[model samples]
Target: MKKRSVVSASLLALCLLTLSSFSTADTLENIHQRKKILIAVDIGAPPYGMLDGKARQSGSDIETAQLLAKDLGVELEVVPVSGPNRVPFLLTKKADLVIASFSITDARKKVIDFSNPYGVIQVVVGGPVKQKIGAFTDLIGKTVAVTRGTTSDMELTLGVKEISGVNIVRYEDDATTNTAVSTGQQDYIAAAMSVIPAVKKANPSRDVETKFIMKTFPLGIGIRKNDPELRAYLDKWVQINLKNGKLNDIYKKYFGVSLPADMLN
Candidate 1:
């Protein structure tokens, strides 16, 4: 009787261990199970994702996210993320995808997959209104602030490094980086033209003006490398959004201009 009782306890222990091992859930599976989709947003990046005076979210990416979720038939949940942590959010399962003006690059592609480029964003160099810097070559020997982990950072770093004396100051978010330049702490800030108007509004007396420096690059949604199905869904839905004029309307509403013809395709 003692041996039989001991055997039963051992079997029960094994069952419990098995259950515990299998019970820990996968994030994507949990999301699918719950019938919801999570999209990461950079609330600090205006004209992309930011709170208006009413505290409600409004931006190009916010509107795009809503449309994407509607077409996906999943509940949309926006997960706010900063510049440096956006990829971490997606990798850790906090966000199912990122629609936050993320650029497509080979370095980023190693960690996360991206859909075909939906649009292109022109990167510009801005300085205090009195000190307008027009060219990348001119940035040498100057201090420039750029958001960490962005293509702008990479582009500027490449330019700065090539010149022997330039200094690159990196920040984790757009607001801080903008503050650095507008407050006269940094000489210039590398940023997107689409979002500059909103930043200008935030700092009314900064006397800042921006100049177009480089042509824009492709922007696309980012997902984990394993999520091919999700990426395909996004690719198809973006096409639909373009055809229905939703993408163009969103761009015009935020940027005050229609998207380039190539951007729609």
Candidate 2:
């Protein structure tokens, strides 16, 4: 009887140990089995994400995504997602991650998870230098053009509704909105300040310039809500890169200015 009991106990212990080991293996495999990370990029947002003239990927977000995939031991697939469909692509699992300039919002958080902000930029209303709007209140009765499906569009529309008499025009991308403002077809344009330098550089003769105005909000990388484990990995990875000065180096290389200490600290 004693011998039989010992044998049964040993068998139970072995099964439990095997099960435990399998669970651990499965968790690690989950992370590693993610062979390729699909990233979304807007071929429009410069200094953060954009496509080169030949349609090659090159930008801050591209470099950051590349380094992140390297750290995560995965290949990167950059998916071109414009403002309108970026979130839809992420929600549908067409992309594993979105390195696009996605802003973290309470409304957005309900659908997706955001990493700690990798970078921050203010959004402002821009117009021809002569008719510059000075503040959000000044925009109360004006027609504002914002990129469709972007936080800027949402925020400006909400702001307009709150203030009343404000009209919003949505475009598919920044370039179109900028062109609308430059041509006087739109009263004002809303976009990120990080884009200001590049847009001004691209159209020095347009007489277009940004007004301080009200801030839109900071931005962050977006991930599917089902992938908290992956989201946590990216959040920590961003901190690691920021701590080691890798993030700042990338910033300086593209923007020609060191990142603010607050971003790293």
Candidate 3:
């Protein structure tokens, strides 16, 4: 009876250990086993990520996610996330990765792991050509619009030290912010440089142009913290694509130019 009891106890311990290992499996293993990878993208930010006329997800970020899925030999599932919620989606395990124009910053690095940079984006002050906005300091005491909770908003609100008395007008999304600028409701708006062309294309009457760069930052793929295997995979994928010119092709398709040199550095 004693021998039988010992065998039962050992078996139970083994079972528990096996379950623990499975529970702690890395994201890469889970993705491979599930045959699908969920990626978070901002469908509202066009030229980077957004929905097309057919409501199908289409844009640079969407294409990049598709390429990643292909490389992983898995199906792609895109989760539309806004600027504010992109990090939360990854933290909650709702998405395996976030490619939503996520820029690397010292503050954000504390909470998430970012893959090697895949692109560079410039945040610039944009408004009507006649607005006479030449630099960041020029917006002093003027109403500047930005998408609420975005890097652009943060820069205008807190990053620009030399400027003071700038009135920031926050909106829910880029379209709304652009509308305010286009309609003369806002003095000027700051956003991704890509947004200037998008806004001009959408509203031809609006003569918006980038006045000066507020900040230039490298955009990285967001991976959940402690997922080293997944992070390594993404970093390798970015390096490979960059060497093969596949990444530049994607950039040109959306931005009308090759990937900039500074992004690689």
Best by lDDT: 3
How well does candidate 3 score on lDDT at residue 228?
Answer: 79
Every model: Cα RMSD to truth: 5.7, 8.5, 5.6
Alpha carbon lDDT of residue 134, candidate 1?
Answer: 72
Tell me the tens digit of each residue's lDDT in model 1 across 1-265: 9999999999999999988754633545556787888999888888888898899988888998888777656798999988889999988888888989888888999988888776668877777667646777777677778899888888777666657767788998987887776666876778887555655666677666676565477889988876656666678877887778888898889887887886675
Residue range 27-131, candidate 3, lDDT tens digits = 999999999999999888888987788988899999999999999999999998888788889988999999998889888899888999998888888877887
TM-scores, all candidates, are 0.84, 0.80, 0.86
Candidate 1: Cα lDDT at 84? 84
With candidate 2 superimposed using the best TM-score fit, by how many Å does residue 208's alpha carbon deviate from the native?
A: 1.3
Global local distance difference test of model 1:
0.79
Location of the lowest summed lDDT over 10 successive residues in candidate 1: 21-30
lDDT of candidate model 2 versus the reference: 0.75
User: Model 3 — TM-score against the truth?
Assistant: 0.86
Model 1 steric clash total: 1
TM-score of model 1 (CA atoms): 0.84
In angstroms, the error of model 3 at 48 is 0.3
* Per-residue lDDT of candidate 2, residues 1-265 (tens digit): 9999999999999999988744421212443677877788876778677778897878888888888878878778888887778889987767777887787889989987788888765777776678757777777767878889787777667666657777788888876876676566875677876655665666576666787645645568887665656666778888898899997788788778876778888
- Cα miss at 235, model 3 (Å)? 0.8
Question: Ranking under TM-score, best-scoring first?
Answer: 3, 1, 2
Q: Which is superior by lDDT, 1 or 2?
A: 1
